[model samples]
Target: MSSSPIATVKRELLVRHLEAWAPAALHRARRVIYAHGYADADGGVSAEAAMRVLAEQSDLVRGRELIMVATGDDLGAIDPRLKTISAESGAGAGLAVHTISGGTDGRLPVGLKAVGAQRVPVLGFLDASGSEPPAPATVAALTAGKPSEMLLVLPPGSSASSVDAYRAGWPLFTQVELADSEEPGELLVYATTAGKSLEGFKEALWSVDEFAGVRYRDPGDPERHLIDISLTPHPGPLRRELLAHLAQAGEATVTELRTFALTETVYRAADATRVLHTLVDAGTVTRRPSHGRLGGDVVISA
Candidate 1:
């Protein structure tokens, strides 16, 4: 069966993130564990994307590995395709693919353990399509004191409590509600400890081309504004968030505010800088080093 438009957008975003993350991850980690929960029969949409990343970064994979594990009730259809990819990618020696035919919630943990992922860096994409969300503990265990991250897809209109439960163990998280031509929409939660990972995720998020009939909503927005998916994203949301942050902080340096945007908000550091400049021109905020261009040391107060 073909995927719906929304599914296509989701998959595109997933591919973009994997492409952006894999290169940096391969540099320090011994293995890249990609665990897919509720995996599609054909190894999910991003498997090829992962292979492409591995192929492109072949030089970086001196002795490192990319282990792709797909878990579902019946993943028989994906095994051969994974083998083909492993062989064709020209990196077979560093590629390992496994298919576990069983419930994802149960099989994912076992699959991850079986592949010896406990000590390595793992990037897990857990989709709760036909099964309940994996226990929060399971997701947390993957990241506890380790250089691991998880991307979660929760059902439309999933309660805020459930979101909180999933975010408990991670020091940082970024969540966006993806709304399409439907009543309610899916929620994507990306949890990680490293600020660099969040930055890469935002880069991946904006890297995708705008798809028709799809919009992204930030749940934290009081107005619940929906943003269009575009290469040059709208900065209105970032403007508001920056002002609010300044209000809370009273005063901060340009460098500090940029860091806030990169880590705490969906906007990039450059986006934050531009918005702050506009605010300065409009007399909305005052800067101490007002004579020259706004450098990192310039202090700004609301």
Candidate 2:
């Protein structure tokens, strides 16, 4: 698709402003930390994803440090023990941690506390779902006696009016827009920082190639940085197609199946084989008993 002229102008403006703004923003805090309240259900965001975002931001705020604290339902759902391990690791890494229950007012659950001891002034809140940005009192408490930056990361279809309410009050903050398009999803990040070259910053945003698409907007009177990109599919469609094909076949030698099903639309034999094995291990499919060739009579059956 052709790029829109407005998008081009916006991109140019964004790079220019961030180059001038990021340095000043980082002047007070030597390190910036990011934390997510929830994962995108369509293609869940994890610490790995957060790290990618932070890495891009790090390039923008050259001298400053970056830390991450990821919270939400998926962590517990994917692996509770792993979640505990990650939290402990965060503390060891000197990162403040908090757990967020999705659909709440963007506040941490009752017993959770915002990370304070690290002297982190700016707290990036990812995936807020409620009507308000956050209570001023809550903001006061979170940033208490410290210079801080608060950015909101929200999904598409979020209430713009609610976001506007917060923007009206906090002009320095930026909003990063994320939309679930395709598999991996894309995020449009808009923010203003001091002493950073907007061009360099915009380039940094594009470094997240794992995402299918990305875009940036400049910081100005209506300072903006917008990123529009699609998410790379995980486990991809080809793998799924291979599994389905195998299920339909009832049972067949790997070589026989590969000859009939392998194509640009399907996974490579190696990947398909791996996926099949995974399904078998998960009990979603059964592997026939065979002690011969790696490409033996491997029957895929439910």
Candidate 3:
């Protein structure tokens, strides 16, 4: 399967945003290395040409550091060459590899052994005809800023529940939405995990919770639970109802909705209040004094 054109567009927008923000965040680095790789070739525009296109669009890559290019007819089979080019680029190099995978082509070879040594984090694009590649678990692990290690594998035809279990073990990884042709229209959760892969990691993900929800586990201390939440696309119905009730009622004491909303959802009144407060902060709702009640009225609106 491949990614939809819309998904590709969205991912491009996201990449642009990230590129704009990278410099500010990495002000201390002397230069940002931009390493480019391609999975295939197309009419006139060779992989080198594509690299130039990326370099042109990315302000960070404009004469700031070295630009390394690697291309092959098949990316999965040429993992070692990709690593070598990445290593030659320099240490602490920021990589941007573009692989042309249509999805379901088996995992594109992305090993951390070489890139990890450089301590360089990479942003990648797997271009195809459908949706963008889901965020890789390796990226999620890197975000933890911890030295721990773990390997996350998406076995062939693995269920959503299996992915969720892997996520539960690594709480530090944030979820990103991914749409790819391999699963067309199916939502996938992307999280950062350790750069290192441990043997049997894939089996462990399958052995755990059978539910289709994300979980966080710390590699250093596997006993600690970070977060465990469902990866369902739609927001919970109870959450929506509570917001609607708050909108209609203007403002009701937290106690008033405990039985119907809070208790039913297994959320404490404090949590409910926090949600409402966040809404208020975002200007989606407003808080005011209650004229006759013990608590205040929360006016929910756009």
State which candidate has the highest TM-score: 1
Tell me the deviation in Å of residue 194 in model 3. 15
Runs off by more than 4 Å, candidate 3: 1-3, 25-54, 57-73, 76-111, 117-160, 166-184, 188-302
> Please, what is the TM-score per model?
0.86, 0.39, 0.37
- Worst lDDT run of 10 residues, candidate 2, spans 216-225
Q: Write the per-residue lDDT of candidate 3 for residues 157-263, one digit (tens) a residue.
A: 44555455545434423222222222322232333333222111222322333233333321112122223332221223335556767667765555565433322
Segments of candidate 2 deviating more than 4 angstroms = 1-33, 40-44, 51-69, 73-75, 78-106, 109-114, 117-119, 128-147, 155-160, 173-203, 210-302
Clashes of 2: 30
lDDT of 2 by residue, 1-302 (tens): 11333223323333333333334445657755444444433233343334433333443444444444454544445334334544544333333234454533344423224443245544444334322344434433334313333434443444446445444323233333333332222223332232122223334433333333333321111322233422222334434555656667666666555433332221234445666666666777666663443454666564
Q: Sort by TM-score, best first: what order?
A: 1, 2, 3
User: lDDT values of the candidates?
Assistant: 0.76, 0.40, 0.36
Estimate the TM-score for candidate 1. 0.86
| Count of clashes in candidate 1 | 0
Q: 149-175, model 1: which lDDT tens digit per residue?
A: 888888888888988897776887878
Candidate 1: misplaced stretches above 4 Å? Answer: 41-43, 46-62, 129-131, 181-184
